[model samples]
Target: MSKALLVHPDDSVATLVEPVAAGESVTFAAQVVTALTDVPSGHKVAIRVISAGDPVVKFGFPIGTARTDIAVGAHVHTHNLATALDGTLDYRFTPSVPFVREAVAETATFQGYVRSDGRVGTRNEIWVLPTVGCVARTATRIAALADAAHGGAVDGVHAFTHPFGCSQLGDDLAGTRSILAALACHPNAGGVVIVGLGCESNQIAALLAEIPEARRSAIRTLSTQLAGDEIDEGVALVAELVALAKAERTTVGVDKLVLGVKCGGSDGLSGLTANPLVGRMSEAVVDAGGSVLLTEIPEMFGAERLLMDRAADEVVFDRTVKMVNDFKRYFLDHGEPVSENPSPGNLAGGITTLEEKSLGAVQKAGRAIVSDVIPYGGQVSRAGLTLLEAPGNDAVSCTALAAAGATAILFTTGRGTPLGFPVPTIKIASNSGLAARKPGWIDLDAGAVLEDGFDAVADDLLARLCDIASGAPTAAERNGEREIAIWKRGVTL
Candidate 1:
């Protein structure tokens, strides 16, 4: 494998695939340059002289402006680079990217639970959701009791606890209700028991009214206020759900699957390895007629146009424009920088700016056309690449993806995280080191892309994911790290 990788011809720097010592000769993109200083693996090395304030290009786009004159072979990172992004800006619908539809070959399939409403689920579990944070512990206790008694029958019994639904008004209350309603209808849950605290803003009756009519039969509701014994009532409801979800798995086509592509704790190798690998998997799933949801709006700041240009129609392009600009306005509205990302872990892992991160981050979408753009807590309607409105935060974005109808999430990480979503989260490590060190966190190692190429790795990943969809446990599931976090963006009374 090459010691360094230059992602684009005009890039001023190349990513060192492996750590290189000072004075060591590095070859990238067929060009040789001696390292002037020790550069860590996944870090950048200047390939050419860059004047101060000049743009540093990567992925054939400017990532940031150089803070000082950068000499060839010198290390390039936050110390010498600063984001060029500011507040919200005007956008035009210029859909220039061509969308090629690949013919599905043989049509891949997985064994999944097919719901009565025609939706497919990768897991057969019972979910307990609280209508208010006041009942969070009660919900957890109920889930624990149910899992201890009834987990062996279905996939498992789990509860998603959150601290909202009360003291929230307007969009905040609506957002919480939407997410809960979405979870209630998720196919993964064989039965859903909605625990309510009686008079919370997110009342059970109101929340149930929002759940899809087709999925309402599988959902059960219980109010602690009306229960003779809240825990006993919750356990009984969960038991009923388990019995309802006890249906056998059936062979379903890949098109029935909804895959969520995301990356957190990203390092420079993320773009080259895991992200690209996940992109191939995304392309495969899309080609097979499945839907792929890509979130992390702020991470697409500089790379937004690339996605916009691939919009399926003028309406999608317009919606994509709104999604991007609205996120920027959100940042500016709060006195925060629009490009406030490449978090500490991201920088430590070698990402310099949100642009550089965005360019790499968007690779998970592959080259699919944007079929739609869903709002913060909206459900997915089409079967193609849909851009969901969400922040760059991990748990919040993953939860949004789950609420948007993803059965499984493919999360690529270079730095590693133990967090998991309400759904199955298959962790792909960008580097082999992280995979080796965090065996309990990573399900696949995408570093093989550098040695074996994306074709082989993606093929393997797809097969593994199909197995996971058939009820195989992911690293997160095996470690019992399931959790959820809703985006609270409005007034909280």
Candidate 2:
């Protein structure tokens, strides 16, 4: 195998695909260099001489600055590098067109359930939501019993419980209510049952008021304060909704598809393998006249410009700027720097700075022109690429994607995670080891791209996801891993 990989021609360092012992000779970029220090797999090794205080380049961008003079083949990471990003900066609208288009002309279709409201759903499932934390367990019990009793009725039953709706004031409570309302109205959910304690700050009445009138008919609400037997009552209500949801299955074109994109537990090979593979899938779906939602606002740090320049119009460009800066301000307002990322896992996996991570994370969006922007807890407003606002937390961002009407989420991870969201969350592993280690967690392996090339692997991944859209369960679904967490941006009373 090759000793290391040079991601871009301008990169000053190369990523080691395997451990390199000290004094070992390896060739990179047509030059032979001896290793000055032992570097593990996925770690960076300097391919050229870099003076102290000079930028340490990777991914063809300055990830950080060298803390000290770096010799050839020296390990380049936290000890030798530091982030150059500070607070937010001014941004301008400079549109750049994507040279390559990944969308196709022919129509691709998936089997889905069509609701009375004319929305298409990849699954026919019932979602149980608790308006207040006090009734969270109550919602879970109802879901368990309903799923057991009506196993053959629809797809499945799930309960998403969150610790909110009580003691939360202002926007925090509003955020909780809006997110719950959004999930309750998601197209994947054929039916919904919202349970409430009746006295919490988030009332069932106010929550229902936020849902569209047409969607309300498929939603059933209950108050534990009034119901004689909440569990039985909920199951009965679910039975009625099951009957409504079991109507019929129809074939829908790619235009009816909305795919959510995210990456978590990323490693050095993420951008090279899994992320870009998902990007190809994104371009394919977007080109076929479908919508793709990209969230995790804070993760867009150094790579925001790449997306901004691809904005379809000035209006979208402006909105994209506001979203990026607003998220940065949220961090500054909390006395945290905008570059507070590349967590402990990320560091161990060879990621050095937020800039480096962002550059890789945004690859999931591919080269498609961003068509629109959606606020936190908002749904997709248009087709093609749409950016959504949410923090970098995995659960929160994936939940935001699901709440925004994603039929299925394409989640790439170099370091594996078993966490799954409400809708089908397909975990694509960046390296072969992780995929082999977590067969039950990973749905597809992007590691094959190294041998089979991106086009072949991208085609395989797109077909796998299309199968998932057409009633084939993902590894997460097979493992029974469905969860939801809301973004709380307010204070508690």
Candidate 3:
């Protein structure tokens, strides 16, 4: 394997393929250079002398400015570099990439649960939803009871408990209601039992109004205050839904698949391995006439233009611009730097600035055109690629992806996490080391891309994803890490 990788010809820095000590010779961009300082694997090292305030190029774009004159072969990170990203700025829709839609093979298909409304589901399970946080435990208890009694009759019984639906105002309250409503309507839930506290601001009636009447038959409602035994009532309701579902799976086209692309605990090799590997999967899914959703708006601070340039049309380009700038405004309004991302975990994994991180994060989207832009708590409409408005937080963005109608999420991580949203989340490891160390956490070894090539591994990944879609459980699901988190951006009442 190469000692270091020069991502782009214009890059002045190269990522270390392995740790190197001072005075060690390493080849970068086909040129040998002596390491001036110790550099860790996945961290950047200056391949050329960079003057103070001069831009440090990586991935063929400027990640940030050098804090001081960086000598050739010196380590390049936060200590010698800082983000150039700040408050919102004006953007022009200069289309650089042309939209080229890949042809979908008519023969591609997967086994899925076809809903009455024509939507396809990757699972046939009973879901217990709470209209208010007050009934969260009640919902969980009911799901546990139902799972114990009727789990065999269905895929499984799961409860998505969250701490919202009350004491929230404006968008915050509406976001909670919308996300709950979306879950209630999710096709994966062959039957749904909505548990309510009877007096929360997010009333069952209001939430039901958001769902179509066509889906009402599959959804059962219960208010603890209105029932003598809410758990028994909820279980009975779920049983009836289970009977109605029959736990049957039918063949569906790849067009029915909706995938959410995400990454967490990313390390240096994330961009080179796991992310790009997932990017191939994303492109293949899109080429198969399926839809893909990508979130983490803040992480796109520097790489936003790459997505904008791939917008399907002028309208989509405009929406993409607004989504990026508005997220920046949100940070500025909160007195936080726009680059206040790349958590301690990210830095530890060899990431430096938000720009470097953003560039890597956006790779999960592949080269698909932006078909639509979804707001927080909104559902995906267009089928190609949708850019969702969401923060960089893992839980929040994963929840948003689930609420946006993704039946399964492809999550790449260098530092593993056992977090799962309502849908199945497949964790792909960026490095073989992490995969070997945490077999229970990683579902796929994307690090193999470095050795076996992306196409070879992506074919395996696509197969794995199909198996998950066809009822195979993921690591997260097997570990019982299901959860939901709504983004709260407003004050409480």
Model 2 spans with C-alpha error above 4 angstroms = 29-31, 102-105
The digit string of per-residue lDDT tens for model 1 on 180-235 reads 99888888888889999898988898998898687787888998998899999899
Candidate 1 error regions (>4 Å): 97-106
Query: Which residue pairs in model 1 clash with each other?
Result: none
List the pairs of residues colliding in candidate 2. Answer: 103-287
Worst 10 residues of 1 by lDDT: 97-106
lDDT string for model 3 (1-493, tens) is 3388888999999988789998998887669888888888889889899999999998899999999999988999989999998788777777765545555334566799988878899988999999888999999998998899989989899999988888988888988999889888887889889999999989999999999899898989999999998888888999889899885688887788899999999988898899988888778788877899999999999999899888888899889889888888888898888988899989988999999999999999988888999898789887899999888889999999988899999999989998988999999999998999998988999988878988789878988988899988898888999998888888988
Question: lDDT scores for all predictions?
Answer: 0.90, 0.89, 0.89
TM per prediction = 0.97, 0.97, 0.97
Q: Which residue segments of model 3 deviate by more than 4 Å?
A: 99-107
Model 2 C-alpha lDDT per residue in residues 291-332, reported as the tens digit of each score:
899998888898899999999989999999999988989999
Weakest 10 consecutive residues of candidate 3 by summed lDDT: 97-106
